[model samples]
Target chain A: MTQYTAVHGEKVSLLRVLGPGHVWALGVGIVLVGEYMGWNFAVGKGGALAALIACWAAGMLYTCVAMIDSEVTSTVAAAGGQYAQAKHIVGPLMAFNVGLFLVFAYTMLEAANAITLGYLVQTVGGMAGFADTHDKPFIVLTIMFLAFLNYRGVYATLTFNLVITAIAFVAILILFAAVSPWTDNVLKPHELLNGLPYGWLGVLAAMHFGMWYYLGIEGTTQAAEEVRSPARALPLGTMTGIITLLIAATMTWYICSGLMPWEYLGQAVTPLFDAARLTGSTPLMVLLFVGTIFSTLASANGCINDASRAWFSMGRDRYLPQVFGAVHPKYRTPFRSIVFLVPVALVFAYFAPLDQVITFSILSGLLEYTFMAFNVLMFRKMWPLGTIKRGYVHPFHPLPAFVLLALCATTYFAVFLGYGTQLVAMMVFYIIASVWFAGHRYKFVKRGAQFTMPWPRPVGH
Target chain B: MENLNNFQLLEYAAWGISALLGLWMLTDMIRTNRAHSEETLLSSKEGEIEDSLVIDPPHQGGHL
Candidate 1:
């Protein structure tokens, strides 16, 4: 407690203003958009039951992620998430690549959310008899609005996220209740269930899309610097967040699959909105309409927050540029990094088609997940158990790491099966970026200063 | 421009506002860079320090 107070007396930085609830909001908010739209692409690959299997399988993968992250982040206690982990446990090049993965993955997700918001607005305009409305302005405005929330401060941004995320989660429950699968209601799972139209291979293929269900829950660690008690808050918020998303994901699949045919549900742009429409209830449709809009906004807002933190940490260590490391004096936010990534996200949002935007985001996320498994193994082997105090330590030893690696490999293969060209292209982009960073950026980083966390020396050396 | 409908005009308004906000953020960032020294703004020593709540593991050896 004395040490905590001592550290706060003299630094200009991100405010220690977040709690467990903010952590939950940040994690869940980024992911709840999948419940509204993106996860149905799994249904496209497999049938309904296969998609459900993919959902739980993907859920198992993220569960391992949340566990491994809790242990490392609780001890590492830095803002860069896996980037910081790599810096300490892995090497400079891997840390640099992990940084790029976090930045691109979240930035692309932000773009996807912005794109979805634009389309949803145009959809509303179409229904209101404005036939020729453009989506570009709406896209730009959505990004700008969330950017303002993030720029102003962390507390307001996440609190707003909490409200919108709760509304979106509840809209799914409301749709579930209105349909009332318990009684004889609108859901017809018996009639609508298609038995693995693409067969077992389809279930394997669907695993990648199943990831959309709880994609960014591990992002809770990015707020490590902001949390008042990271050990308690990080695990509490993250564990609860995973539970919320699993329930929301299962309910979303059940309702959408029961309400609409698996064939149509696979391709629907706004599946939750479409599910409400299928029930012939105007009120439910209105609720879902607003729910979809809010979820996208919340997601984009959370992405900006996480992406900027990863970039800012790298910049602070001179991994990018010192300019982006500057924190705003009054707001105590990473103002420069937040502003720098705006146009990058904006370009991708404004130009890329939404599905392509989402595919890019998922592939990037899968790559980041691959890094986590190796990271924990290195940390445990180098530091060993009880070498340094941990805020929270994950149980089950190396089992989680092994499980995470196997799942990540399977998902990578699944992604390759569906998107071989895009997968290769994204890998090429990262390799090119890596070469540039090693030649240009890595030269400037202060190697010793980067090791700021006060821990005993590693076991070997 | 005159051929545009009410909805189209509103669409342009949204774009204009987005541009304004974007410009505002950039200028604010630039202003911030000038108002503070690089070290002052970048000094985030606390960010690297483990919060006291995360105690070191029971020791065969103590933490740094």
Candidate 2:
């Protein structure tokens, strides 16, 4: 009977083993790697000031996201994150698209992280005169090892993520302290700072890369069903995760902008690591190197855990296939889904260009945000606040929703400024996926069975 | 596959590890499938419950 609804406390479902701390780890783990590497691309686009503005701008977008996501995820409390929210709040077609967005976003990010891990190994080998070292082996090892941990259980997977994420985060703070000393300041913001080089257009262009600051932070809710208490842990974990990212992103931009001139800062492959090297501290360099490697590993690990869950949630509803929905008897995990998505991630990790792969990921995420903006608005209209018990109500009723839509539109335009072709390509990709789901697949979904949450019947229904 | 460099050999080893883990997951899943029905795997019903026995204590009353 409970199989019909996303009924909590089921023995066969994903285990309720995660706490707020683990949720923090999952969300932070995914996004911290961005700080260590890609966010500098914003500097390259706009200049130091543009990068900073875009960082906070994207931060504002994610703050609205975290607040809105917490409210919806708290009420819905399922595994697929926004996919679950869209299913419960909107309908099947929207839910199907959200699920695809999540799977592709995380899978692409996973592949990107895996590729970074392999390249980091090659860099290390180059330092050791083993310049011919192969990165393919490391990539394989990363995907396989992380998959194994996820296959084992959530507790182990997130616990492992927490340690490495914490280390990577501390490395950033240490860099900040070392560079920002009063009399002997290493970070010459006065010297490196150039007011927006490309002007407003550059600032807009920077917004797309600025998203890296907090892109995957919202993924904490993907483990919603598995959290010990969705109401408590969801808000606690997601909010704290955002706050951590805000601090980290600010420090990362400050440190990087000061150490390297805008031209070099914008293009450095590992900006934080490069900043550490510029300090002439071998200890900091090695620590940043390790930090970069660990952050990438943690990111890949979290991505596997998340991407598989989204795929599993879709499978459970027969949105794809029921076979992909099975929980492992002993592990209490979406084992089949984990197994199925591994090869897809590996294929991209091995072959695809990172820049294009990332554009698809960010665009997919942007599409989901578009769905979320409307989903939350509809949620309020259908359920009405105080009609149902909510764990956290975001302050200011429709402000967050309206702001989210505006931010999403702005980000989509920002994406268009740079990744215009990919933006069109992604829209085409999801549109086709949507049409296929609606035309060929909607018959399989049991709409009546889906709305079994304990909340009161929606106002109109 | 002949005359592979050390790095190429390492790649083979990594793939080998991945294959072993993959095969292990597959076989373990197969074992679980054989032991339980698809319905039990997908449903909330504890499929392992059938292997249990509720041992009834001979009431600890005045006889003790």
Candidate 3:
């Protein structure tokens, strides 16, 4: 029998209550705040100017990815985002892998945010020696708290995301205003060119850290199933979100690099704080710190929301156990999956070193990016233009997807040469996922109906 | 311990992700062809059943 309800016997569906603003909030909210910390590490690798170049490239990369993603989501309108799109273009096995990797990426990113939150609290509170053990509780608590926000309902979580996202952006703008007057010498050509210290290779090195500036823009599609009129909302929300991020990224690089040397900025964990301290303004430093906290909270909260949806989608499709597919009767949310992810994230945060976690997260994200580009190519061939109504048609045919795929392939080779162990770990993860999928096929088919690809095409044609 | 540059890491990921995709697509094509052939056979069987029903109707008692 075809299952009419959600898996686990619940007659539940994700409510389509989100609008363009909410979509924008989710998109920007997930990524905008990285300027406060991780992206600065790129400065160390490539000097300031090189890092800036890397950042710009990453922004372009995101813009391209988001544009293609917008087109796909507008048509697919499924809960699992890239995974769902994969189903239309590829086989079920591929879709299962996409969904699993997506969940891993989001959860890992969430854990990174939680760890950063712990560090931020430690810095602001002057908690020396507390990081060795005390940070664990803080990280765990942050995860649980974010999970609660998502479990309440989409309305509550998204409304909170919108409010906090606005405040965070305003805080960044205020920092810009404060730094502008002191930027005469800071913005000089000599200072900007100082980034070439490590030479051209530094530019490549900068990409890893620089990517943090706009890493999660593509994640917006994960919310498509929850959006009202996703075909219309996705493009508007994603385009606006990326443009805003680009502006914010440029302003941040200019001001932060201007105030301090690339080397100094690279070394500072709280780059914004160090920049404010340069002005001899105590108030500005405190305000920037507060903004960092808000941004961290928003990123973690948004990831929890997105990750649970991916997990729930998998469970609903019977790729995993159905228990994870259960929805809250009162809240109309995937409450079980949200609850399940908390401990898993905490374990990762507690055990893994921060840099390793970051590396792993980036790899997982790249996997999704790779396949999304592939899917775009395959989907266009399957449902050629004019066949299906499109929400947003990317003007240039296959160019963006081809470029993204090429970038991903080359970048993977580079990462393997640079960091073999992490590369091996990612490969191991895929191997394990493949094994589990093959073994579980029998159970999946017996317990749940097989999912059909919804895109229309004549089989023989 | 030298840290890998951002671009290199990206390339590394691309390598792994793309390789896996290539492998999966190859298998998917094989599966799709099998399914297509099975569907063709099923459709042919249905047509034969329809022909049998039309060409040979039930006989009336004794007159046959």
**TM-score winner:** 1
Relative to the unseen true structure, what is the C-alpha lDDT of residue A354 in candidate 2, on a scale of 0 to 100? 88
lDDT for residue A351 in candidate 3, whole number 0-100: 89
The most accurate candidate by DockQ is 1
Q: Residue-wise lDDT of candidate 3 within A250-330, one digit each (tens)?
A: 878877877786657887887876777777878887777777888888888888888998887777666777656655433
- What DockQ would candidate 1 receive versus the native complex? 0.25
Q: What TM-score would chain B receive for each of the candidates shown?
A: 0.65, 0.56, 0.46
lDDT score at residue A370, model 3, on the 0-100 scale: 87
Question: DockQ (C-alpha) of model 2?
Answer: 0.18
Mark the regions of model 1 whose C-alpha exceeds 4 Å error after superposition. Answer: A1-10, B1-4, B46-64
TM-score of each predicted structure versus truth: 0.93, 0.92, 0.82
lDDT of 1 by residue, B1-64 (tens): 7788778888989989988988888887777677666666777753544323322122101111
